[model samples]
Target: MAAFPYYDTPAIDALNAQAVALLKLFAERGYVREEPAVLQPAEIFLDRSGEEIRRRTFTLMDPSGRELCLRPDLTIPICRQVVQEGRKFPARIAYNGLVFRHQPGEPHRATQFFQAGVELLGLEDRAAGETEILSLTIEALRVAGLKQFSLRIGDLALFGALVDALALPDGWRARLKRHFWRAGYVESLLYWLGHGDGKAKLPGTRAEIEALLDARADAPMAGRSREEIISRAMDRAVEAAALHLDPAVADAIAKLLDISGPAEGALISIRALLKTAGINLDPQLAAMDGRLATLKSLGVDPGQVQFTAHFGRNMEYYTGFVFELWARDKEGPVQIAGGGRYDSMMEMLGAKKPVSAIGCAIRTERVLAAKIAGGA
Candidate 1:
């Protein structure tokens, strides 16, 4: 039998050294470094993450028959620690570890990968917290010898605001937001609204019921009862089919759909669109505006940084201000570091109250690869 290959590569060792140095710098800045366990309960992920993530988790049963999973990400488990240990507010926690995910037909997507990140808990001021997180991420990249990267920032709260302002029905709003990433579905909505497809349809069985009742006025009560049952089922089916959206709301969403540009310009256009629709902007969003102004004052040009209005990472636990750092020259899947505010996760993990939080994870391999390519 052939033996499995065992090799120690210099590139891997250098990447590890770079990661350790970065973590040490974070620790010197008073961040608590943790080595989290490799295995965790499967329920922790399924309960907090979205369906797509849940499906991708690596799950198995233990010898004691409890279902367990390899840790897919470190944030949730760290939050769980805060809950179980009853940690205090404003905790600055950092972690470096390996995570696992099953990817079929995508061999390049490693089943196991390393992650390093920090979570700031119990900071209620979203704007201040967001700015700090962003700054820390930029510094981390620089310390790791990375330059020439652009940050793409976004706000999911803005998307929520658009949904609420348009007065879309609960179900349709949910469906639309859920599928907002799909261009075809969004276009279909526009087409439907333009063609007057918002009219509600009456079920066919209701007409049959009226006709039968008229023709057999003296029919037995049991036969009438049978028709009523069939009619009720048909009514439910009709209600289900009438899930089309309101035309005005559709128009509002269509306007929102086109909102993407440089940060300042996009904000101006969005505010105008909301005002024209008679919807007031949320005061909390003003904080984000203020932070953006601060960044501008600090010489980070809005034109250089792409600000997407409806942008979101795949994580559902993120509550605000998600961002991804991408190297300028990298083309495919160019995320070296990413994180966002996840204030509610600790409470969901059974903490006494909401612990405000923000975090970012650097894919160490990608960071080193970019650095080498840049001749660092």
Candidate 2:
């Protein structure tokens, strides 16, 4: 597909047919369809999403002086809509629409595409929420006539558990979790934890951060008060001075990121690794085991699943149980669908309290491509 798709009438009809089938499937599962505006506040995406999305987003100043952007992805917008509409919980919302992003230097990559999926909000049972979404995505692909896909699963909760086990300072914990999705940054952070000499200096001087803390009554700067920023800076300085990560703990984290294999085997490997490090993650491990068992009960073959300890997708909002479904194409395995649980996202997007949520999005065009390649 080109940067902009221009399909003939027949092609458009065929594409709509696939999308309609998906919407129907979602409705049958009780996901009420929603249509969020294509134009959304730019800061919402920039602030909440990961760096990968922030750079690709297309932004412009509206006549009213607010920065607006075409929706980069439906999940954020849908969640924002839920918060805006004061929707009650246990909400099952479905959406199918075009999202826009700028694909610099990749003209062949479509800048606009159709993503259809459902979000289960306020589902107290996280494992149940995940299983429902995963089963629905797989079934949707099969319903669209593509089969033979493999599952790659990961859980950010595992890493969070590890961080908590280490008893790291609050500031350090926040920084580590925020930057977890970056490719090489985690290694740098681990290195800093072990060797403070290699640590990058804080951006501003002690006096500067303190002065911001002392001052009062300033207009909202980028949605935060002067005090919040100053307090965070001060916390980092105090935290950095307070602790040093044991080299052994750093080694355990590195080893964790290196793990990848069959699902059960990988979990066993992780359990062993944490045990040796004097950290117990049995609760997290058991939760994972329960999820896999639930998936199998729903007909997802365990043999076809692989677990990578470090595979958090580009989206930083995912707090747990992430996964990707890959289908073979002319080149190799292509990712046709992916999603995960982001329980904190609703609160971040303005919910009164934390809302348990999980969802997945299917790239409709890629589904079609994989179908054609498999001669289905």
Candidate 3:
């Protein structure tokens, strides 16, 4: 088999052309080109990129026993560069590169592909920042000859605010956040909350958990010693209560997730949910409105954008505002581009302080495939 994919003349040319055009857009907007190393520390991804990406990552060990992997995505490696180099804030950078992924038994899945996009770092004005990133992505698609696409937007920060307002137990907050993006999982979680056997859904009574920690008091796990585990469990005793979800709060969350349509209509539904929950989310609502206004000012029709509460795309680092652009096809809608804000990623990559950032990428292969199919 070939070391890498072999593309025919037309497809190769198309990829090259799309990359150049997309990079030009970024360049004109002050984003300098950046290319991170192809091989990176595997743990960086395994620890931060979420289980979906982790499972598909192509990992290996070097001769010296250093764990390494081919880059699964450009965003993390680029963020790693920014933190390591102490790059100045408000930096605009772009990259056109290949990312690798492999599945054990899925031969037909894409193993590698060309991706081109930009990341805007340290822009604190979120409304303007989101608008800039979304607009740039749309323009890049336009340059790639894409004409019709649906923009689906979601805000994790908004969802987080609602969860906080609900006053869920600390342990349950983590569990719910973990499943926030999975529509089915979230629905089931809400069900468990409204109708679970009291105390049975917990990891065990506080004392039982502590006893296990004490018994394994010498074994180490994932870097934590048994003593450390016991101490941690002791700290978590208050949080590990039975799964008790208030029926009203569960209904509110379900309603929020179900609010999907034009931007304005979604906002209306969100406000209703907040009112029913007796929570004042003025600041978050204002931020969402600001983003919508920013999008409108960028020439996108607010009516065309669909906003939803549970729209995370499985990228673990996306701290707020995720979106995907889809084009209609004979089979259904196919995503051509997607990305979002990941303000905490730099910290995850070892930064000493918080860093603000947002970015998106276009799949050159997918764009070309759509073009050839005459569907997008």
Candidate 4:
């Protein structure tokens, strides 16, 4: 496949047929089909979706001089629409459309791709919400003729629970949680905490601070008075300089990140690891168990699920229960679909209060290819 895919008549017909089937299934399941705009405000994605989206987004400036972007994914746009419309709770929304991303060098990846999925907004039942989306996603793929794949699951809430149990300083906790999604960064942070001096220095040294103060004497940055900005920098400098993580605490985080395997065994290992570290996450662990049970009840085989401790799906908005479904193409294993619970995103998108949101989308191209390869 090229970055800009060229579909012939047969390919086009197949995709159209698959899309119709998906839309029909969604309607039967009580989802109202929604068509969010193809272009969205760039800032919303850049600020909330994390660095991966920031890098891939195709940004443009409209004639009005406002920055806009081709939506990199459908979930954010759909959620934003729901918030803007003041929709009632537990909104069952479904959509299928072409989403754009810049995949410059990867010919196998499309710059513009057809995606179809559902978003369940304002649903407070966490376990039930996750089950509904995941099971529906599986059914959608099956209807599109997919046969073999495995589910990879992770929970940011679980990781947050572990961090809270460690009893670290506020600054250290904030730093760890903020960079949780970046690859290799957490390991580097752990190493720095263990080896470096306890004190951390801000970028503004005494001379630098004086220069900045002189330069900004008549100006305020982002509504912050010069005095206020300098004061905050100084305060954070003091707090950061005093921040340090205990070697035991760092070790605990390392051990947790190291645990990953079959889902049930991973849960057992996490429990044992927490016990040895003298940290109790019974409530959190029980919640995870409940989700797994719910998944089983919804027809997902426990044997097909894998769990990893540090797998926060690169989207900063996801607050818990992230997942990806993978299938092998001729090259290797490729992710065909993914989504998770992003409970905090609604408030970030201007909702009056937090709204529970979960969704998953199939890469229609990949799923279609997989279906064809299986001679379905």
lDDT of 2 by residue, 1-376 (tens): 7789888887788789999999999999999999889999999999988888998999999999999999999999899889988988899999888999999888888999989888999989877788788889888888888877888999999888788777786767887877789777887788777777544565356686666555744545678766677777777677676678887778788888889998999998888888778898888888888878876876777888999988874888889989999887776677889999999999999899999999999888788888878825
Report clash pairs, candidate 3: none
TM-score result, candidate 3: 0.84
Task: List the lowest-lDDT window of 10 residues for candidate 2.
Answer: 197-206
What are the models' TM-scores? Answer: 0.79, 0.87, 0.84, 0.87
Please write out the lDDT profile of model 3 over residues 276-327, one tens digit for every residue.
Answer: 8788889988888887887777677776799877777478889898998877
Candidate 2 ranges beyond 4 A from true positions: 195-242
By TM-score: ranked, best first: 4, 2, 3, 1
Query: What ranges in model 1 sit over 4 Å off?
Result: 1-9, 166-199, 202-246, 282-285, 297-299, 328-333
For each predicted model, how many residue pairs clash, with residues at least 3 apart or on different chains?
Answer: 0, 0, 0, 0
Question: Model 4 scores what on Cα lDDT?
Answer: 0.82
Evaluated at residue 263, the lDDT of candidate 4 is: 90
Per-residue lDDT for 1-376 in model 1, tens only? 0022122588668767887888887887678898768889999999887666787899999999999999989989888987898877778888887788877666556677678888888877767777877777778888888866766778776666666655445766677566665556765765474444543443346666566567877776664576675677577556556554455556665776667767777777777766666677666458568757766764566776777766763677877678887863233445788988777788898987777889899887677767766724
RMSD, candidate 3, Å: 3.9
Q: What is the Å distance of residue 156 in model 1 from its true position?
A: 0.9
lDDT of each: 0.73, 0.85, 0.81, 0.82
Q: lDDT-based ranking, best first?
A: 2, 4, 3, 1
lDDT of 4 by residue, 192-295 (tens): 66555434445446566668778767665888766777778777776665556677667777888878888999999888777767888898888778878876
In lDDT terms, how accurate is model 2?
0.85
